[model samples]
Target: METLKIIKIGGKIINDTVALQQFIEDLSKLKGLKILVHGGGNLASETSKQLGIKIEKVDGRRLTDQKTLDVVTMVYAGKLNKTIVAALQAKGCNSLGLTGADGNLIQSYKRPVTSIDYGFVGDIIQVNTSLIEILLKEEIVPVFCALTHDKQGQLLNTNADTIASELAVALASSFSVELYYCFEKKGVLSDMTNDNSVIETLDLEAYHTLFQQGKIADGMLPKLDNCFNALNNKVFKVCIGNPKMIVDSNSIYTTLQL
Candidate 1:
């Protein structure tokens, strides 16, 4: 089986033009099949505030009410996806921008209203591995935005990290998949305020300990959940770190092992 790399990038890299450009350039240098899954940083929220819409979140996952959902769709599937695709194109990579709606790439349903109502937020149920495989075989790099849809046509907000993880898991049987969760920090930090405090390798036991101690909370919580889920399902490697580390080996990063 060929090796496939599914990279998820979020944090400040989404809004930083220079950094995003450099990151895409570096990503293009990586050989073999690859997919890019990206998050909407403050773009949705900022756009919301401008339009007089309120943004809400529960556990760092946005509560995608109807109004907020529209904004996210525009920002995530529109401006952001195209920008990344254009950059990758300039670097000589044939990039295909995708919302989970396109080619029926991802199928999901709205998150259940349990203790709290998550509104239009989605819980992904399926990914079309065949479609992704076809694109890869054609040498097309997929650039995915954090937006998925119900096969019935309703668009839903999805988490990019989870998307990357699920995609890796779906492709694992056909390829040796490496799932990467990239962001602004060098890696998962022991001290949130210190950039140098990267935990080089994180295991399931350490992850549980951190969660119990309240060291990992909010957004990091689901991301770690996805990481462990991917590993347990047989992803070859899972990583969290600076985007540049996707190309540069000397760069510091965190590698997750089960």
Candidate 2:
């Protein structure tokens, strides 16, 4: 079995171009990792705000209106995506930039509208891993943006965490892979404020307790959900931590246990 790793870099880290460049340098030295999924939410939101577009959030998830979606696509798929790809290439890593629209890599359905329409928001329906396999066979890392196409042929913005989870499940089923959800946090902390008290492992029961205690709120909620989802789908392992910690196994990071 070939070893593969699907890493999802958080938007906050992507916004810091220096961090992204360093991350690429670290990744280039890894021999067998096949793909990377990147988020551009922070950049997208910032760009949208500068362009006079209001960003709406529903339950901690971005509510992508038409204008917001356009901005997101431009940032996630256009600027940030290419920048990462270029950075990796300069570091001697063969890389390709893509979105769900390319090769119809990800298929999605529009989110149902209620009080306020999530104009161009989507829920991922499927991922075509064939294209990814081809890229991996040639030792090219596929850098994906969290944008998908709806059933009606319109591009819709999807959650980057969701994209990473779905891609992890797909790749794990097809090959041996480790999925890492890298973010700004050191790890999932037992006490939200203390980085030293990071929870090294979480099982389903512990996750439920944390959620019930309201400790898991805001962004961490969806990230935790994605972690469990990947575990349920039988990915080899899932880790949540800062990007720098991912390169050091001795460094503490939250590990999801089945």
Candidate 3:
């Protein structure tokens, strides 16, 4: 069985073209990696603000109203997706850009917000791995944006981490795939104020403790949740670490053990 690697690149690192290109160059060297999922939330937010748009969030998740959804769709599916595909192509990697809506690769429903509705925000409920399997069998890497689709055939904004987790679950179930969630931060830290306070590894039990103790909050909370979700779904290995440290197994980061 050929091995596949599903990597999700952080939005912050995607902004640096030099770094992004270098990352692709590194990935191209890997023999059988199948897919890469990327996010551009920071860039999208900045662009929205420039266009005089206000971003609303609840519990660290973006509330994608119709207006904000338009901006994000352009940034994630249009600009960022193409940029990544081109970068990988320049590095000699065959890449195809896609979103959840393409072939309904990932199916989702509108996330219900009590008392207020986030127009186009969604919670991913299903992922169709058949399309990815075909692409991988052809040795073509599928680069995914975090955009999903609702049952009504409308595009919906989703968290990139959630998208990656769903994809990881689907791919791992059908193939040998390693899931890596790369971020700008070094890893999950025991103490957010200290860079050296990184937790080297975590298990399902430990993760629950951290969450219950209020140790993980804000952005880190969702990321950790995604990691656990992937692990629970039988992904062989899931790592949360810096993008530059991806090639180094010894580099400090949290590896979620199944």
What's the TM-score of every candidate structure?
0.96, 0.95, 0.93
**C-alpha lDDT of candidate 3 relative to the true structure:** 0.83
lDDT of 2 by residue, 1-258 (tens): 677888898887887867877788888877786688988847888898899999887666678877887898889889989988998999999999998889989999888888877778888989899988999888899999888897567998888889989998887878877888998787887787776778889888998898888877567888888888988897888889988765776888888987
In order, the Cα lDDT scores of the candidates are 0.90, 0.84, 0.83
The better-scoring model by lDDT among 1 and 3 is 1
- On a 0 to 100 scale, what is the lDDT of residue 33 in model 3? 64
Q: Report RMSD for candidate 2.
A: 1.5
Span of 10 residues, lowest total lDDT, candidate 2: 57-66
Clashing pairs in 2: none
The TM-score that candidate 3 achieves is 0.93
Cα lDDT tens digits for candidate 1, 44-95? 8999999999878776667888999999999999989998999899999999
lDDT of 3 by residue, 75-129 (tens): 9999999988987888889999998899889889987868777768888988988
* Ranking 2 against 3 by lDDT, winner: 2
- Candidate 2 lands at a TM-score of 0.95
- How much is 107 displaced in model 1, in angstroms? 0.3
C-alpha lDDT of candidate 1 relative to the true structure: 0.90
Worst 10 residues of 3 by lDDT: 242-251
